[model samples]
Target: MEATSGMPRPELLQVADAVAREKGIDRDEVLGAMEQAIQKAGRSRYGHEHDIRAHIDRKTGEIKLARFIEVTDDIENDFTQMSLEQARIRDENINLGEFLIDPLPPIDFGRIAAQTAKQVIVQKVRDAERERQFEEYKDRTDEVINGVVKRVEFGNVLVDIGRAEAILRREELIPRETVRQGDRVRALILDVRREQRGPQIFLSRTHPTFMAKLFAQEVPEIYDGIIEIKSVARDPGSRAKISVLSSDSSIDPVGACVGMRGSRVQAVVAELQGEKIDIIQWSEDPATFVVNALAPAEVTKVVLDEETNRIEVVVPDDQLSLAIGRRGQNVRLASQLTGWDIDILTEEDESERRQEEARKRAEMFIKALDVDEVIAHLLVAEGFTSIEEVGYVPLAELAEIEGFEEEIAEELRNRARTFLSEEAERLQKRREELKVADDLVEFNGLSLAVVVRLGENDVKTLEDFADLASDELIEYIGDADNMTMDQANDLIMEARRKLGWFEGLEDETDETSEDAVEGEEA
Candidate 1:
């Protein structure tokens, strides 16, 4: 057999260099791909069953093609492996793990072989380009990128961001923003994922962080760290709200974000395709922050429920519609900005609710303590909401109310305790009649009312309760009870513990089976 020349192919090395530079890949990888093409052609000339391998010199692009037969102690496949005794016959120093190399002659370039080689080289170069793109874009998530619109297909914009392409889906684009081909587009890199086809870089123009970054670029105070963006919410091409806080006491964060004569905000708005921007001052106090978030509408007062993170904002009658915005946009953005649920109310509505609550509290005190309306009204007016407060509050606190002495306070407290004791007895009887599970009754933080409601919902057994999700429990009880998802999870977990539903019995079963097998073996 004739041997191929071992001389360096300088033209081949030059081609490898050019392809590597064009594809933004390593030159050695390209040379390795070329060697693979040559090795495939060599295999066609030699036997296909032989263990053929290929390598290319990195500096000179000289291809070496050979067939390898590995020496083994117990040879199973003769095509790739040879026994140690057989290998020793060829070379006395041959080891069991070493390979016996056999050089093969190069192949003549046929039409089909050259086409197959070209295809292999092209595929390898394409794979390298994809790997390069994935590595380059995966770290760029959550960053702003500028690209040109390459084309539009089915409302999805394909952008050419210099080296690689990114996709901006229709839903990710700002509303009503026309992106024509060749137009410069700026968007936030929402995600970079390596899929089966290649790397997919998802871009978004409507994400809240995009607006925040735009402000960071536009406002010197924000960019310099004098002002920080606390939160941002957008209605896309319509309106957006950004809450900013100033670290320096003298700098007005809202004014700084707005810039001189609205220049800074207008630039962001123009980029967003005429999206109206509301620059709000941020506050640690959620109520104050919410008031600022719902701009162009005045709030009369704010009542915050710290336990549930809800804020009730009362505005004048005329400002109600404005506070809620068109279709509740104002209140919705305010809720998002402050990270709290907001309930907007008119001043008259709030006044009516207060009066009704006061009446109910006065009535409750009158019935529980056997007091007249005047005395009950006095207790209710002093912020005593329930018999529990009357029974547990210090005697001095009750006496501090107008027209109340120590003797009267002591009598009221005694009556409140008696009433609560009777109520507990009644509830205990009701629970017994309902056949509430003993385990549920004993579960800490599971109130009597909750157990009764659970019974009514057919969740009578611990097993039944354990089968329920947190939201299911909330649905059975009610959100008015102020039951949080965490509390519901705790209650359900307690029920599960009582039922031994998560005792890892399956794991124990596996261990027991293994032990049985070992005992038999012994």
Candidate 2:
């Protein structure tokens, strides 16, 4: 094993071996990097325009240096390409795509060339190290990793995790938790992304998943799959709630998470800087889950609007403040844990609201049905909430009520229908006054009041309504205004039908029209 100069340069192989061992990279990679460095130096010394290249023989540790020019029919770069006619003068057998190599005398190790070579090797090694780090940590995302704080920069902590350094951004740290150099930190690997500078390994101690993982570590039942963590909501360094379920009926999920004398939860709480933790039993029923999530605060009742995933929780007046917690944190965490939007109300407030609703219904019945207050009260008490229901209910059902005969039931039903028709005519006149488009008025799922409101909001055309998302439509007409997101979605879809955006709609219509024509002919 000797150099191309017939001199012993065994140091090259030894250096490659040492770099490969120390950097945990391939020996061939180091050798190839060295060749590139030598080639760069050769280009600098001979001429920058020459196509200089260097290759090292793997077994012999020998370096070969040469300048190469490609034989081409039409030469574009004179330094690296030659016309066939010009190449034929140099070699009669020259052909296109063949490299014409001229071996050069060995390069002397000049001070400047040595420095340039060192820089190239350093850059290549760094690139290899970055690639290795990315491969190592990319698969470890979502798992907790421990590291020592190497430095702090403008509040962001750079942690040294063995061979790699990961960044814990300022916001990723738990609120008010200060970290200093050399401190041992444990965090979830939230993201591992490759960027222009290098692969960025992002760590977070404040993520909800971090708290979930900590519980998993502390609870054996969770780790063994007997108990499962359903969801976690964290107000880092303040409080948190976790919902857990048990596969076995005998096992209490919440009790298991709490452990004997509250030891398990306290271990997690300590790790999270004494953040108060509430462990609740998970239920498939959304209302029940909401009830369980708002623990330590007595809830009188929970009414869930499944269409909106919103729950109205009525608590005892004394428990209202506690249920809502300081600045609404308890309700907020409960909402997050149950994945439901929550609205808290005191029992007294609930009773008042119920009374007000009943009063409105009674007045509406009295006015629309042309009935006495006693009869309207009877109708309202019987749970007939709207004119449409009274108009549509079976005559037998209405007559069966006390003090109601067939004649009275029939008259009430007729009055309900007449009132609905008059209301429709009024709304239609108002709709026209607002300049609502006829196409939008004909769209299914949008009521007359909704159409009038759309006109007021400048969403008068089918195109305008089609452009709105379900959420946008809900925002326009208020979420609590007798319209669900599903209904809004249906309206938008019907509006799109007018634009022929649905592929099968036209075909179905055509088929139905042809069937109707066939029936008429028969």
Candidate 3:
């Protein structure tokens, strides 16, 4: 706000006091802020302008401005200069360097100076009020706030709480709830942060406790502590799970929540876009808790591991798909709520898991040609596992390694030589087709070490993943867990791109983008 020369100094003081009152600040604070601002702007460049002082006496409704100037024996006797005679009159012990006070009229303020003072006073009062609001709300995290969705801009929801506007990002929005202009949306205040602009309000409706809060608001038993929430997990629009308990055992937490005709829950369900909500009983036993977590799955036996605080639920082979949920979401959320590592096991998965783990152990630290688990299995046929034993055996002793006839080893080497020869030709053609310059593409420049690895068929230039036998490829590579089945597909994309075959290769791109993959896991 700007003040003009037309307005009288008393009129300006009235405006400042009005602003301070509206902002819940003392009138003296606004007057002091305006005086400091004018002094800071008009004073010398060195230290602060301590010579200036201002007062707003509430009883008189008058303002006074004064400047403190030092007195000297040979007084300068200027407009702002004071004499030792004047200084010693105020205090008889006053020395030559002692300061004397002189009052300046408020009417002396210039037009621009008055405007600056008004702006400073308004900003200072507003900032102090915002800080006070931030302190009041800082400890109220996860508590509900009634707000109106003010506007949606750039996919962000601007909510108008009574005191301020809160920003709810799209990630925190519920799938079922679409914020529209002027919609009265209730949200939990996730965080309170003080910023220069004001108190930053972080609001969220998708938080799991939103369900508990809604129930607490609706159900008298829950509000009065008759029913207690045990656990809650939500998938926003589609589903929610809440386990509750009764303290007195006479009143049922679930029944009170569901109401006689499911009236209470229906209010919550409707607010959540009719999301399916499962209200279950909580149990102290880990087994029962785990079973309840994996709802609609009907786990037969829950194997609890105390050391890791994990639960292994073995479901029927047919029910395995149900227990894990679509994309394993059901069990994943259950594990998050229970703070347990959940392993959903089927009879077949149990068997395959053990066998695959054992197979990995048999493949560690073997040389390139001896890396195959199938080859190791065949070697075990004649009692051999370590690479140290394989190197000592006769050239004829390779017959002990699976698929290792001296002749097949020779054929394998020959095949690699031929593959490399064809690779050079294929790379040359690809370079031409892709318009690669001589400076860009190289075929004969590979290191001998890399050539040797390729020579042993340890690493092959992938043509495509769908064509390559992944199970067999896993046998050839030793670091089984580090490499995922998806990597196999990605390798094919890399080879295609290197060969300048860039068209329509979406099924796989490369390992760098695995986390940003477009679809659900295989």
Which candidate should be chosen as best, given TM-score against the real structure? 1
lDDT of 3 by residue, 1-522 (tens): 112222224764777778776776667666667666655544422234346555555444355556677776564545445677876777787677766655554544567766776677667777766765687779988898888888999788999887667888887788746778999988888899876678988888788888889999989999999899988888888877888888977887778999979999999998777888888778888789889878888877677877557688888799988888887778877886677789989877776875675565456422334345665555545665444354455656665455687875454344434555665676555445544333222333333322233324434333322244655444444341234445544654455566666644544565436856644454
Better of 2 and 3 by TM-score: 2
Please count the clashing residue pairs in each candidate, in the order shown: 0, 0, 0
Against the reference, the lDDT scores of all candidates come to 0.87, 0.89, 0.67
TM-score of 3: 0.60
With candidate 2 superimposed using the best TM-score fit, by how many Å does residue 402's alpha carbon deviate from the native? Answer: 3.0
Q: What is the full ranking by TM-score, best candidate first?
A: 1, 2, 3
The RMSD of every model to the true structure, in order and in angstroms, is 5.0, 7.9, 14.5
Prediction 2 TM-score vs. true: 0.89
- Model 3 regions lying over 4 Å from their true place: 1-17, 25-28, 37-50, 69-90, 94-100, 347-522
Which scores greater on TM-score, model 1 or model 2?
1
| Candidate 1: regions farther than 4 A off | 1-5, 453-458, 469-486, 503-522
